[model samples]
Target: MLGCLLAADGTAQAAVSESVFLDEMPVVLSVSRLSQPINEAPAAVTVIDRDMIRASGFRDIPDLLRLVPGFSVAYTRDNTWAVGYHGLADAFSRRFQVLVDGRSIYSPHFGAVLWSDLPVAIEDIERIEVVRGPNAAMYGSNAFLAVINIITQSAAQAAGGLVSVQYGEQGMAGLLARYGGGDADRRWRVTLSTQDRDRFEDTGPDGSGNPVELRERTHTYFLSGRTDWQIDPRNDMSLQWGVSQGDWRGGRVGEASEPARRESGAAFVHLQFHRIPTPGREWRGQIYYTRNHYDADALGTIPGWPLPVRVDDHLVQTRLNLDIQSIQRLRDGLRAVWGVEWRRETVESPQNYFNQGTLDGELARLHGNLEWRVTNAWLVQGGAMVEHHYYTGTDISPRLAVNYTPLAGQTLRANISRAYRSPTFFEQDGNLVYTDTGNNAVNVVTIPAGSLLKPERLLSREVGYVGQFKPLGLEVNAKLFYDTLYDYLGSQKLNTAQCNEPGAKKCFQSVNGSSLNLRGWETELHWRPLPHLDVSAHYARVRIDYEAIVLDVTSTIIDDDLPDSAPRNTFGLLARYGWDAGWQASAGIYQTDSITWLSDGDKTTGYTRVDARLARRFKWQGYGAELALVAQSIGNTYSEFRQENLFGPKVYASLALDW
Candidate 1:
């Protein structure tokens, strides 16, 4: 399936090169396998342009994702959040890949991303591209479900100083500022930004469900610099570097305990040479290092001495591309892209904790892709990748895509691919210790390590259509997809005797589960009746069927068939209006159905939320200023997350901002 997709993409690349310019091209959202416009892609793509971000009045990445179709976001507790696409979801680990400026941000320790820790400022984002299907052939593992890339604005375009301040109810307050500029000849720019948010209260169990007093705080700082040096008219070299830090308090177990604190930092340097020796060729290289640390000292009577865990990772990658349209047949242009990557990870524990043993592992991958144009209306693309993990062995992934354009404004796309997820240290060999009080003394229960876990694989197929009409100023897009899982790694209870030695009642370990099926569809509509008025709506439905399985002890089929942290029905709406007088008003509503909790029998209730914003801008000689107001949860709807395992309080807000 992957091989065919790669071949089709190669064909499309050949056909598209003649009509599109690399610098001026618009990228598709869902087709992360290729960097091409939506009209020429063979998959569902949703492009969230910069204008949409500004009009939505979102102050953070999570808020902005709510407007995207086929995605669901839920707060676990405190400042932690779970976001997923299609149907697959989990509290600590989600099956998706996230990138910022072509760098993977998913944590290797937990196989998930900390959405709150994303460093780029919302105001500096140029666009967000979301692909809602498997992209393993191009993006490698962790792209089993979907891919989300947050592209930031170039330094040249953001050359000014601006500041924004806002305060609202529920102890919410925020500030963001940036200053950047460089001479035309020098072609250099620098920016620095910081964001802070106060902890929000949760719903208590007082029947009336009043706000619970849980203190939480989060902050992030970022600095980036870039310079461009033109070697000649046909050759140019650019260098860029970015560094960011995020700190947050959450993951508390009880009211008497101190909240968990997590800190993460990243630094990256990239160099690129475009139009080197060839007319339409480019080469790029990057090196990055990241560190993530978590301290959970107040967890379950652990005392003031926190359990500390840290991960340090380093990666180096390079890519080279050749566009052969000018030398080859005009209709048979050939484009090829290839790259190599290397990564190393090291983990440490402060308390001599050996459960998750500290180890260093290395990985290497060789990947290449090709695009070919078969005809004016039909194009094909294909690609394949091979990777070797020192501990998990080697695996191959491939993809195929076919795109057909029946009319100038209509596109039909189909894709098939295979992807896999590598096992983490926690899954391979980790020990967990839990304690229970017996007569004022702690009774420790130890969970032994499991060394037999295997990697998970998914085969996915999808088809979609996109259309744009100028007569009604309307755009509509829809997609249908199906995915099958094999060797899905899940934790299951072993025989009672495994841990029944006079104390514990249960023993659990990692195991391979039966195959599962996931199918879903998403639809979105956008209408602009007037130049200044815009309205949009979207809906998503996902269905999952877990095959029956027998418990190891009872030998009876498990009745529950729900996937964890996944909602069945989700929808959203947005409306915004901007006046010539520099005044803007916006409002939005979002709703999501309750999700099952960790394959357990528990369930969470659904809730609806509303948000509103107002802003105005004033211009002076060589400078401009802006003020804004923002509010979230205006409806005060009562909502619970993680199947009632966590809940949020009704919040009201008003904000004053000046820039």
Candidate 2:
């Protein structure tokens, strides 16, 4: 549920008319691509509303995800972050899908979301809906594990000029400005923001394994605009565009890290149209274009090389996607929704692809879901998606769910689903080679892709219970899930016959080499005991088992690291209160058990984080203004992803004004 409403029209519908507890349950639109209440949806979901966003006092979108159950977040460096669900996650969150206003933002080059340069600002988001299990039947490939949908506020809500500025320790500073204006039929808004901060005081060492000190820091800027128009009584449309750019100072060209300076940028344009043919029917279409660019230049010395090597890491990625969907009522108790989608992804990189020219791929999908109320106490939902990809041919993902309601404010749900994840271009066409001044391959980082790669598949089963107590003003959601993954992609050293390329030596290939299984239970509680107070808490327990482990002498996939990548227990708590007429206070506490990060990450011990925020909201000089003070990580230094990177106490102050 999104802490918002979603009527049959499906475009963030206004509040409902009835006031019963069941009728007032939070509504959601991401599950099954249909508008329904939380208890009636097929899967478990977590919603982060605007109020929680402000109370958490987090500037990074990934950092704010700590509130979600069964999620793990790590800071790999100044510009890199890793987020995963269940387990088996590296620097790239390959199995997860993320969207902003129905536009997918997954990168084709690295198989991950570019968190450092996301196009939208947190202040502009209305809410985030996170589906906790496989949802490929509604979304497409790469929705193998979870889905995160970020919905921004409508243009009409941002109808005034607003400004915010902040300063903090460790070179933390930021500024943001927004303005909006329109008439009854048309509305528009624009946002501009910039920020700079330091990530680590000193990087442990360079590639050569020598004692060294390097400061890692980053600076960023973003601009975005949105427009909404109500052309007529039954039609409306929206247009949105944004661009974000950032620069990070990093370590030299070491084995694990690269570049002294890295520049990253992202841009996107999204347009959507909606039509309401009748009171119970609607059609919507969306088209989006997105691009990502990266550039890095550095010089380094290999252990046995005679001369320095020039490292030029440059990459450009682009995506064009379009989709249309329709929802109509067939009868009194039955409704159906269907959609079609197409997308193209392209990548250009000489350094990474080893002289391979620009590469591109295409994908097409068709999907439909039916929701039928069998009786007053029983509801059933089923859907399937068929997708054709340039690499993996065609595949189908399907889901079936059942919901039972014995009483008005209580519901029981069960779901079973299957999903697939196509192999990324990096996994298929990787050719990493280090060249010296003489143009000779000095270090064979990797050879090339294997021709026999296949898509990874997942099977998810879950049972859940949700209940809302109107008198207590409390909500409880709990679930138990079991998941299995097959044909898992892993790396291995290939022999002469196993090498797909002729005359290839010491080939490092990607293969369908392993399987994984996970079982877990998680719970979330939302309590608003008083009119001026809000409290939320969550807990998760996970157990991971490896059916097969891929081992390569030259690879980093160790036996223990694969099974210990996920924490066994996780907990979080959040609280907000209005202490006085103009005073507000909030606090959050989070803890994670010991776990190991795969690929470039390291083993870390259990850690706990605490944060507090105090603010005063009032009207000054005929303008809405707020002054806030925040304290974060109020404890001893703790490691994030690596032992070298430490987190400590920090304080910041900010002022926001609206006119």
Candidate 3:
């Protein structure tokens, strides 16, 4: 009944006319593993194209996500950022899924994305497609909230040499170089980039400096290569490899209260093959390997402390994944996809996060789906995946969706899905150590293994509408969604007999004692009033209810604080203009309502920020050159979550040459 009312409201507001498909409408492929018109996708999705990426004036990859609806972006430290969809965020985001090309980038040790250590550079990206709802049936575990696919530009699109350099306030400097060339049948591209920046100045609510906080600094370097080969008329292959390394100083040190040091390195390789034997049928296979190494050393002496203790953390992990899938036309208006996947993950640490000297895990899955055009005006889609894991036994995820086209330019859809998030290695087998010196001798405390932990699960329902008005140069997407999450990996104090030390204090293990309910509405609009001008707007409202039964736990525990920072209202707007005479400019604004941070449960003031960019292109010796200026938080000083992580005005200028 509520879904019906929402659809009727959208129908009444839609301006119906002689609608025709535009020749240049963007097509997306993340929804069902096949290319389809954006309005005809099986789920609520937002695609940010090259034009939008260039106009956003965001140098980092995570900032680009602000353009999408129902997403939250926050800064934690100098180079650490947190991004979430529909509002469960932490220093390391664990609920969302992120992929580069076809390779999952989630770390096996902690099941989190290290945004600052990603290998791909923003300049090499072609487009980003974000799914606003769960897609576990198609993407597997850890896709419980949303999925982000970052597609890089093909070698054909980058056919020459380019150089770019930028310098800005806050001790920021960046340099990038790329070269691309190939024959008609084969192509290759290579890129190298370096970045350096300073952390936000620690300040109080009144914009005054606080002496106890330590400042941070960061430096990063990256190198990447990609190649594509057309072996024959019916076969093709592509390979990509990259490496990224960075170091930073932050956190707190001993008695004098200095900064600590941390370093990380990552490398990845991906290979893909495609075959097209006949029309209406295709097959593809992919394999990838990733490695990550991280180390942190932090220690601080409290008032009246006698000794300096070690507060260092370290981990090294690797992952290998392979998958194959086939897409075939079943009948006149029906299509099907079937696939299998095998994954292996292994990790090693200094006996800090795992009890054993080493830890390893494996997973296998089989999935299938069907897309049936029941009639000219109706479509139905269903899919399911069966996964087998070493720890949590076998589990199944499923989804069902239906679309109704009542008019030539409008589509309405209703979808329901079941998704799960498998426990990370750290959660299942963690042995973190804490030393207590109150008794004159070290009393080492360890977090016991969660041998009985279960996978987190989500049941979600959503209603969505998409409308296109080519005559008016407009497109709109809106959705209403509800979610119920259960079996979350929370903690509970164990009985004396269950603890390693029978009478120890603070001995805990993970359990399933939490449930969360969330409901929200999101809407996005795009309008092109003229050939050279465009505007986009997005808005969202969300509400949540949470309950947990964890005995004797602090309020800062995971289950108690996960939803505290979810803002009730969020909005963004963007406008861009291009002139025929080699000039372009863009401006944008975003706002988020005040919310309490989980780290300290401190409420922060709501903030509004503005960003802008201006550029001019010219030819020099038959080569293209561009000069641009970018600014963020133009005239405001605000904090996203932490008072020390305040955001102030920033300006930078860049020069680029392409041949």
Candidate 4:
């Protein structure tokens, strides 16, 4: 595989550099900095462009993420998915942060992301930047493991009409349509899409039995527009707005219930001003506002039992940046960014289901960062953030990093940072009832208000190396990282009868206790061995350990095994061939090691699964088109998340047209 990639690299470099080399290509976005070249950034940043998305023929964001190093996707149901990265899995993956055009996508209620809700259109996405490390100083909380930023294309690039349709196994159907065009100077766009899938019967390891049934349906609509006004020779102002809505359905376990539905949406508006301060200095300022909402119905319950809940949230932020060169010396420069932000949220729960509650709260933060170039080959960056929450206590985070470029196309980088995760309302004052065999009874769990719940802190360190050779047309990047968590927030069971009357039943409290350690390594390689062929592959491994603790004075230590949801190893590979006649063909595969879930002292064995896709593109008259064939679960592996089950099946073909 490596030899094939290296040969293709030499051919591709000779073909592109000789004809299409451009000096002003926009550098992809990075988590360590606002935006910087992939090699210049002091972190491991992965970029998946729109062309790659189309060639892969992936159906959604979760599918596309399989190609990224150190990432895995686990499905809870037909329409719900959990993403794990850098050794952290679901329910425990609070360390990662996700954003879409600078707007937060991580759910504050559960501290996890529902990948299906993110509005990702293959045509609208410009690129996805995946950064592996702690970025709390630049992105605030929930950035201890990694950061994923999805950036959309400018309106100018989407000024046309396009339509696509797909159908496959289990009565699955998908439809998408988009149209937009404006004056040469101003542009706008709109898109509408819907997907529906009939439930499939689940099977056991041997693939035969009466399995559970699962089904799902979803519909989404989006509208956005942008305009640029050239006010002067040195200044230009731009305005943009976007809105989307989604509806979903599915099933629950151990009960007969109607499909649960949820609706979520967001609106954003931003204004920016740029000016030249001096001969080689520049400054930019921006202000924006965002609003989000989520509503869901209870899982399984009697008809008309009243099971509905809603969350409303709003955020306002302002940022300023300055770039100066030769301020004090000929080779020294300074780059600084600072900002302030505020957020308000409200929740309404009427059914008292699923940890329902009614609460309103606000939070504010001040953050800034500065980068300095001490020498031609050495660079340093430092930053800090201070945040205050209405219910949770204040927190301060700091970060430092360095980059050394010993030679052209060869770079080494390292980073050290301190980050934190604030306690959620559900962890502070909510009440829940849970059943445990160890306690031999149903226990009511309640967290007391006004109790000290310190923010979960992490001290992280990373080292990486990246090399790009023009002659070989190959790019290789590798990194290793470790993190130690203090005061990690986790649930613990207590015996209420010990303090109360002997006749009372035992109860437990979901309180904060114990610590955890996580470490991992990731590698990504890109090679264009031939002018018509390209190959890319990624591999990652992670491990996690939670300290032992005594519950109810039994002096029992929690198991040392990692979380059940995190996979120890994951890997993916893609091969593509592009022809001069607009003909394209590609095939790819993704595999994940089995996962183990522990319950009642029982450990489950893990399994592995595979998927593949093939596609072709062509143009006729004034329209461009593509057709693809996809087969998911090529090995037909059976898997389950919690009580929900899934079976791998084949998805047939899809056709797309654009003008």
Residue-level lDDT tens digits of model 3 in 441-554:
122344655455788999999999999898999999999999998876665555445565522455556566678888989999999989999999899998878865645544
**Alpha carbon lDDT at 328, candidate 4:** 15
Runs in model 1 lying further than 4 Å from the true structure: 1-26, 29-34, 206-213, 228-231, 234-247, 251-275, 299-333, 350-357, 434-449, 494-507, 554-561, 597-602, 620-622, 643-659
Rank order by TM-score, top first?
2, 3, 1, 4
RMSD of 1: 6.2
Q: TM-scores, in order shown?
A: 0.83, 0.93, 0.91, 0.81
Q: Give me the runs in candidate 4 sitting further than 4 Å from their true place.
A: 1-26, 91-93, 198-210, 217-245, 253-332, 351-357, 432-450, 494-509, 554-565, 596-609, 640-644
Clashing pairs in 3: none
User: Model 2's lDDT to the true fold?
Assistant: 0.81
* TM-score of candidate 3 against the unseen true structure: 0.91
lDDT of model 1 at residue 164? 58
lDDT value, residue 246 of candidate 3: 88
**Reference-based lDDT, residue 597, model 1:** 43
- Cα deviation at 139, candidate 1, in Å, is 0.8
Best-to-worst lDDT order: 2, 3, 1, 4
Candidate 4 residue-wise lDDT, 1-659, digit = tens? 00000011111112113222133222544454434556666567787877678767677776688789877665555355656675445533456777664556565555556465555566677667777777777666777667777766555556789898888877677888878777744556676776655433442321344454444556656565555444444444445566667666555443333335666665666544444445444344444444456565433332343432122111122212111111111234677656666666544432212244456567777776677887878888788878777666588889888988888778888888898877655555444433222222133434342376777788988898888877877888888888888876655544565323222244334445577777788898888889888888898887777755665573233333445445678788877787776677776777677665322112223445455566767886778988888777676655544433555666768988999
